[model samples]
Target chain A: MSYHTLQHLTVRLLFDEKFVKFVYEDPDSALLGLDLSKEEKAQLLAIDSRAWSYDSLRRLRTMRSLVEEFKASTTLVLAETRQLAFLDKFFSSPQFHDSIQKRGSMGLAFAEYLSEKFRQKELKTPQLADVLRLESLMARCRREFQKIRVTPLPKTLKDDLRIKFVPGADVGAFQANTVLTIQKIEKYLFEVNLMPAMVLCDDAPRLMDLPAVETKKKSYLMCVPAANGVSLIDIEKSDYLVLIEARSSLTIHQAIERAMASGITKSIAQEIIARALEEQTLHLV
Target chain B: MTKFFDKIAKIPRLGVGISGEFGSANKGIEACLLQENYPELVHFFEYGGDLDRGLDEHVRRWASTGLPTTYHFLDINIEERIDLTSDWLVETIEMAKEINATWLCGDAGRWHFGRRERGHQMLMPPILCMDSVLESVDNIRQIQEQSALCCLPENPPSVVYLGEMHILEYFAEIAERADCGILLDCAHLAIFQHSRNLAPLTGFDNFPFERVIEMHIAGGVLKETNGYQYIDDDHSPEPLESTWQILKYVIERAKNLRAIVYECEHNAAEECLDNFIKLNEMFPCKIETPKLTVK
Candidate 1:
């Protein structure tokens, strides 16, 4: 129990590069106020000076995983600026680091951090906020889907089958057309076959030549866990209403009725329900 | 001797180990399963998963085959009292039961600093002192009691170790106080000895070999940075000579040893076959026929 402080300090040494250097320079001064024992203090001082390089390697590993998790957002950030300044600022923030320590999804936490920056007008990129939001929702949906024991879909949506929105399925409204913007980003990434190594080395070709996206129209998209990855489906306000009603376990007929009560035409409600089942966004139980 | 000794003796030899996202990536056991001769090579799976991530489809598929499995956790910090929450224990036991795990095992190291998160995850060796050992003992005992399964504490790999006690002595004291089994990861021990400039078998003279229920053999890469040379546990097919030396020293001494896992999940089947043949030559399976097979 008493060694918790030692454990805490050691973790900081491994992760916080600045602190590692401070400790490496003057161990006694850096660890002055801690309640560690004399032997523990000696142990702390004995840490290899080369730990900074190890920590650098660890940070690279983290970046590699983050690239995989937030592909679209990372692609946009890199493509727009051709530099890692945005990422550097985000990774260095104490708030983001605290989120990582708290076991939060790195994608979701980064999305939240970017949203804050956008709110404060810190970000000038027109479509960056919407792109990050889209990726964050997809990441959340994927995580929620992973935690559930998914039941196999029936051959067809039967009248007797109970239907509900897949656990963690969510909808978002964005100022920019995220679906089209992501499609362009994916195509750009595919054409270049961007590798983390290239990005790390600053050898990646400048992508600033890409055309700016239109950011005036409001776009509605639903993110759901798909068979391979997350699926972002373009939808109308009517479809969103139907999906919201389907969140609770209900028969297809009941969902349609609720949608109709919400001012969605019965035929439109039926059509959206049928399409949701086909996309596997709404599951039969 | 405790009941865990007999329980672990039932585990088959020549198992395969995988951790992290190896299962999801279709590496580790998946690669081995693709081989036509895997039935002769792999007897059981040491399914290592983070409790937060749960098991993936590949692990579930392996479990569906009714193969023997042992759950190796990657999330818990057994040395930190705050990390041993009741909720964590419940979730861990649930995951172990889901895979029908034979027992539970993980490295007795600081898995994370404050909370068990992906960013904070690491494999630093415990501060090798009596207080750390006592704390770890209490935690291991709690895990064993809560899960009703034998808990084996593994010695974590580290480039730099701290404290007056040797790594072997630290784990030996925990095994005695907790009344549990031990998982002797030879590669990790090799790394520790090389870091301290000690012989491979320097500290084994007083170790509780009989308490060792499992042994791990993993490939490591030797690299030097800033005038410090250390073995990195990269899980390649070619294990260091020091690892093999440690394994050879303990093979006969570990009286209760039931498992010797080749942590070559990242290697291709052809690349691992040579080591598999070598391991089979050293410890032949007790059962004449393979217990698990892939279609």
Candidate 2:
């Protein structure tokens, strides 16, 4: 399979998006697509999800076991808890082990593993400085190892959407246009909407390490925070939109603080930006 | 082993403030230092989601001043963004050597599912298991763990696990098996309180109670969403009523508890720490200080 297809399949399976859409969008059509025998489909669909609540995974070894199970399944179906209880009904069923493994879903396994690690007691008390340093190192390692995709928005709509999450409200029409010249954009909307942002774009520049450009007009050097990477700087006043490619999304407050620290005048605080945008939209409409 | 919440409510001078990243707000620290009753310990918090700044700078700023302090490895944040492992251990110990730190506190291997997702749906670090904790504790326990620094044995320090209540029994069993100590945070226990009106630290009855070496106090409020609730939100300002109540209860019950550290953030953290100091003064023996020398 193509790597692209594999990634797409992974997302579809991880989130159950494709399966959910198929079930709700067209039950008969979905049933037709299932490779299982008619009896199997009936048995699978009739299973209750609440009957079998598997224990959560709180350790890496256990989580790894769960991951291995998921990777092995070809046509994995999340068996309902009752369906799990009915395993005896299909004693010779091929999906029995898979069903048991599915009981300890990825979420359950990962959350449990994290909980165990976070909760374990320490023998030797570490200095807070040392602990923080370890925490920083671990955090970097996690980010660097995890792979992800970055997608940009339509040029015209990116800024408008980004401004909506700025807390104060929307940005002015002029500020929204500033996104066009954006070499980097890091906004919270990208994460929430589940659509990759320009911050993940291949060509976006590092917002923090911009070259000094000689411009005729006074421009705003916007500092946008990249939660997983560097902060951004915008020097173009003509364009309202600036695009940022990111390794990951920034927390809501972190993004705002990053923007302010980037030299956004207090005059352009969230509220002011929203008000200006509203006035501009009114004039244009 | 003083119960952390009571100390926090009872003392007023023990409060300290924490910033997410080191040096993100030095100006704020300068302002804080201006206060007469400023706390001796200030935590510079950083995680994976934060900007990449070397820990050296934060350690330098804190160490440059000869004040006794702590630097918390808000490891959860770092776990979210890094490929953490034994290498991280070497670097952290080296950094500790450089700073001459008395103690180092970090997460066991837990992840906080906050407002956003960082692709953990794909890959996450190996969970910190009882065995993992014991192994790490044993590694740090070795005298050669840091041949460069001379830290005292009296304050041998502690390893803390910020996790569920029931898991305490398992942890205690592991600790007993390993002959190591633990730093118990009262607020975390309260967060794990279940439908049983039993105290959050009830599980400590199963552990080698004598091995508990430190306690943490903080104001924590239960947050409810979709009719479910949990504890350990650092953003909380004042210590919650339940948190303090649990602390007092733990103090009454536990025998091996030691130094109580008041953990909080912003102005509320200061206020909480102040209450902790007063508790220490009011009830000194209950919150015993371990006298270990660091060379």
Candidate 3:
């Protein structure tokens, strides 16, 4: 794929007055209110579920509560779903702008939804149904906030295996503990501040450099995780909180072996990354 | 006294100074230019968004374009990322060194810890302070201990904001005592005049004249915000008349004014440098040079 191809045109045709009017008129209904074939409807539902799963199930619950509380209009809900669909298509498409831009547009849409809802709350004049629509629209916007592109840093920095691995033989031994530690760090960051500085990516290293976790130095610990990798993050360069699911445990090992990974070093980087990520995520959440 | 006169006298032959302290830098240089004090021009290039070239490339581009001396302000997004450990800091300083910048001016990036980390010794200037005058002097002292390059308080006192005069005096004394020369930004002193309540700088004429070694001049705007519109050096326009007057006053008083920089944002406003030329025509001072012809 061409590196500079323009993808994520969410904002490109977004200013169209007619389409906007249609969204306002009936959000829950499909765009144009045309009947969907059974297969198309199923596909749309599948896409919706896929998006919900991408972030977490908690957001779905939030949306349900908002729908109930606001008695939202079908139009606002439909508008939001369409917005989500647009985002999903944009991210999943071959034409992803760098992940950061994707993240920004998604964030903007969500903010707009919330801002609109907040505006609705202050109004003494809007009908109950319109208020509901506003709430539904806001909820839909919130759901797709983290759809971002993942661009790797310069290869000179990323190519070294020394940069990717954590040390300790029992490192894989504490796989569950590692995951739990990451979660705790995330929680701590969120509690203190919404924006987490670190992002952990265990997924394909080729896809991301994982600036958050740094395992450069070696150390000792009581129990080491069976499988986990870490890198230390520099928050100023990359602004968003991060998470990575390494595709395989062996891949994690290879990274460690190449880096001469030590369990202690990994743990330290993990702890810092975890805190930074938590701070960032808390900000976003 | 010969050491002082020799330095001031040779300023026109060497590169002009490029100071990026908002208003004063531009005004000071303009005052020099108007008096026919044509020192080599120092352009303080402030990077804006969506520009393709990095710092080195920017310096090279301007140098190749025939500007005598080019310095960077290192402001904008770079300043916001004050965490010097970040690659941006490393790259920016490396660029400054590569370009042989006479001064690399900066403010603390947001979220800065205000500590110098090891492995960052190769960078230039080593100044860490921004915004506050007192903190700036302390940082300047700390940096001076590490390197010969001068550390500048990002903006000098405005003749307009009298609240700033004492702090400015404090900094002037420090600079004098430290034996470090001043990057007297002309625009900031002009901002002092725009504010009515602050005491004008008439009585404080003897403030730190020996410390000044460089001058800056640039154009800016007069905009209204919060029901008050005032001149700000962030944008470029014709030099403020009051700013030019004050700069002329500085040239006559200071015995050690070395280089004068005509600092402006790249493509800041339509007539930024032209204003510098026009102001030069109006006053006609000592340094020798022809009006800058823009063909």
| Number of the top-ranking candidate, with lDDT as the measure | 1
Report the error of model 3 at residue B148, Å.
Answer: 3.8
Model 1 - which docking category? incorrect
lDDT of each: 0.75, 0.35, 0.36
Please give, for residues B61-140, the per-residue lDDT of candidate 1 as tens digits.
76776767788988888887778988679888998899898888888887765555445567778888898998899999
Model 2: residues >4 Å from true position, as ranges? A1-285, B1-21, B24-36, B39-52, B56-59, B76-84, B111-165, B195-198, B249-258, B268-274, B282-295
How well is each residue in A1-285 modelled by candidate 2, as lDDT tens digits? 121122222222223333434544565774453344444344333423221111122223333443332221100111112122221222122232122222212323333332233245311111112222222323333333322222333323222233322211111121222332222222322242364465356654322322232233333433322444323344344223311111123332333455566665533444433443343211111
| The candidate that achieves the highest TM-score relative to the unseen native structure | 1
The window of 10 residues in a row where model 1 chain B has the poorest summed lDDT is B16-25
Error of 2 at B165 (Å): 8.2
If both were scored by lDDT, which would come out higher, candidate 1 or candidate 3?
Answer: 1
Residues A1-285 of candidate 3: C-alpha lDDT, one tens digit per residue:
110011111111121223323334553452333333343333323322111121223234333333333332322333334343432333232222222223233322333444454375622222223333333333332332232222333323222322211221111111122233334433443543443233233331111111232234221222111212112222321111111111122232333332333333444444433442233321111
Indicate whether candidate 1 or candidate 3 has the larger TM-score: 1
RMSD of each: 7.5, 21.4, 21.5
The local distance difference test score of model 2 is: 0.35
What RMSD value applies to candidate 3?
A: 21.5
Residues A1-285, model 1: lDDT tens digits: 436667656655665667667877887888777668888877767767684355456656666666777787787666655667676556556555555444355556766776787788866577677778877877777756643545776666666678887776777777655667777777767756756456445556545544455556677788877766568777798888888777679998888888889999988987888888776677777
